[model samples]
Target: MTITARDIQLKQFKVKFRGFDVQEVDFFLDQLAEGFTNLEIDNRRMAESLKNAKIEIEELKAREEKLKRAYQELKKNLVSLKDEAQSPSNQNTSRMIITEAQRESERILAEARTRVERLNDDIQDLMKQKEMIDDHIRKAIELGKAILKNNDCPTNYSEDNDLKVKHLRQIP
Candidate 1:
């Protein structure tokens, strides 16, 4: 059973001869009861904190929903305004709005084109880098093949020197 400091304080014992010390038992019980009381208080405080946090979260969610609804309402109003402006009775204003919207659309298109061009340029740069690396790899492979071929061929130094001298004589 749950015990509290007040329960310990209000406890009564019948006095009898040769009975166990009542005062010592009561003292220990009081200490244990006080500890239990503090633990209960702490548990209550933690529960309250959790409740507040949940309440705050719910409030934020409600506010977020309200803002989303407002945004949708604003979008609907903009559509309505556009429709009203396009009515047959408002030709001049409708034409003006159409022209402005077209200009804005063109500007947005131009900006998108510029961004696409920049992205394309970056892609081209990466392609060039990849091509350079491939070329270097091909050159290294060619050099390796040349080295292997040279190792297979036994060269006569005297014949090579004579050929080199003959080539020099033909150079003039």
Candidate 2:
């Protein structure tokens, strides 16, 4: 069982023959009680200190948790910021791509214009050839008519009248 200074101070012993000296034993007991009281005081002080230490540890742990949560939040924000930063570069890249496409479109349009010009030139050449062929056909018709007229094939035939001869013998 636990002993207290008060228990030690109030302790009694049955009187015995040839036992410890009464005054000396009493004085020793008194000194031992005083020592016990000092020890109890020290124990109480240590217990209080230990209780305070436990409270401080709990507070520190709570603060650490709060700081950890804050750190995690900051990390998440940093990641989000890092992701957000790429959009402008992507937009710039898209703009560059669009610009390139527009340039390519312009190049294609220029090529089409050149092709159209060449086709127009070819068409003009074809038109001239057609006119030349028509002139040749007309000249051949005129030559045939002149040969018939000069040979006295028909006396009624004239340039103003179309050839409506029904008989070849009508020509003299």
Candidate 3:
């Protein structure tokens, strides 16, 4: 169950003939409440960050897939153009076919150039995203480490989100 500040305030302790200092108990409780607050805030911040990272990662993946599809289409078009060049049906009007093929080839070349440029742009974007994600992850790890080191706070996370983030990092 989620504990609230009221729960902490309402906690009771048994009174002894000469019990421990009440001020010490109160101080410890205050520190515990502050730790819980910090933990909740950090957890929320980390979750939002991870969500954004995953979104960017998905976008990069989609870009890569689109580039691959474009490349495949270009390859298929090139093969068709090559096959037409080798065919012998228009032997009498070979000049016309050559001229037409040359024009089509030029068009294909231009299209391929455009596709290559787009693919390069996608690659560059993905690279920049990778660097950003890495930087963000490193900073988060550093912050988590500092919190654990400085305050002995719990390091448990809500899910295996880090595994997915690491998987994205591994994608070249």
Candidate 4:
């Protein structure tokens, strides 16, 4: 069962003449519940942050794909323009048009290259962020395991959680 702070607070134990101190147990449970609640909040926040980062990455990838397609189209147009410029008819006009087109294509290509480089850098930064978050999560899990071990509780993590960690590590 997923125990909540309220459940911990409301938990009851049978008392005997020689039983452990009730107040001390209650105080410890309260502290544990508070810590658990904080951990839950942090986990939720991290998940949301991860989700946002994934969305941003997807959008950036889509933009990169569009830019690549545009670059290819520009290349094809440049080739066509060059072929037309080679013809004898309207040689002077063709030269001028070819020069203008070349300049424009070069400018566009340069801008596209710059944008792709920037996007690559952004992706690297995001990957670093993801690594840091993953590290934090691993640390949290280790801490939880330690806590459970100290309490003589089972520390075996769920297979689903392991699969998720593996999946995150697999992300490129």
Candidate 5:
């Protein structure tokens, strides 16, 4: 059973001929009741704070799971692209394309890993990191589509080449 401040205030004590002074005992009881009231208020505030913290933690966990799934999907796509590039029929035409794509993907993956490390260090920027990761995935998908569309991967690759991958800068 929970003892409340009002219960303490309403407590009674039988008085004898030489028992303790009534006024002094009542004054002490009042002080004790006030202390208990303050403690209860503080306890309620702390409980609310704990509840909010738990909600934030659950949200962060869900975001982390989403990022993990996206990373796994990206990894699977890269493996498929590598396998396709290695086929005998397309070896000659896809050599340069494969080389360039590998380089670009590696660079993108490294940058992503770096961003993930930063995100781990500071959770407050997770929303921005999610947006950035989505942008990277979109670019990677577009690059793969372009590579598949262009069957003639010429040896004379240059910055002006339509198949050249454009480097994207991070948004502040």
Candidate 6:
């Protein structure tokens, strides 16, 4: 049966010959009750403390898991970085690509320069031919005007007859 301090304090005993004194028994019961009350209070405080400690442990475990995940992620990143730093072929490949691009640009520039030079030579030849043709036409017109001035009457020297006779060839 559950007994409280009040139950211990109010306990009674039967009276008999050669029995224990009431004051001594009552005094002992009071001391025992007081000690039990203090022990119960101490036990309650300890239980509360234990419960709080368990909660703190769970929180610490969760934090530890989070830290572990973060550490693993960081480790993966570090490994990739190390691989990049250790590999020389990737850098060489980039340099090779740049060299190829430079060579391609140089080849295109050379082809364009050659084409421009050929076009300039063709234009010079065309201009020379045009000047020669203009000189021939001017000479032909001047010679015809001189022939008309020297004739006494309007001669019947038609263009078709003159060309058939090659009259221009007869002139200088």
lDDT of each: 0.53, 0.53, 0.53, 0.60, 0.55, 0.54
Best by lDDT: 4
Model 5 sits at a Cα RMSD from the real structure of 32.5
Which sections of candidate 2 miss by over 4 Å? 86-172
Which candidate would rank higher by TM-score, 1 or 5? 5
Name the regions of candidate 4 deviating beyond 4 angstroms: 85-172
Q: What TM-score number comes out for model 4?
A: 0.53
Tell me each candidate's RMSD, in Å, in order.
35.3, 66.8, 14.1, 10.8, 32.5, 63.0
lDDT of 5 at 153: 33
| TM of each candidate vs. truth | 0.38, 0.48, 0.44, 0.53, 0.48, 0.46
Full-model lDDT, candidate 4: 0.60
* Tens-place lDDT digits, model 6, residues 15-72: 5554445665576567656755655565556456555555655665565566556556
Better of 2 and 4 by TM-score: 4
Clashing pairs in 4: none
Q: Count the backbone clashes (under 3 Å) in each candidate.
A: 0, 0, 0, 0, 0, 0
Q: Candidate 5's residue-wise lDDT over 24-129, tens digit each? A: 5577567667766766665566456555555666666666666667666766775776688788887765666656756766666566566555545544444445
lDDT of 2 by residue, 139-168 (tens): 433433343333443444432134424322
Pairs that collide, model 2: none
Q: For residues 92-168, could you state the per-residue lDDT of candidate 4 as single tens digits?
A: 77678767766776676577667656756765675666567556545544443343332332233222456435543
Ranking by TM-score: 4, 2, 5, 6, 3, 1
Q: Which stretches of model 6 miss by more than 4 angstroms?
A: 87-172
Q: Once superposed on the true structure, which residue ranges of model 5 sit more than 4 Å away at CA? A: 81-172
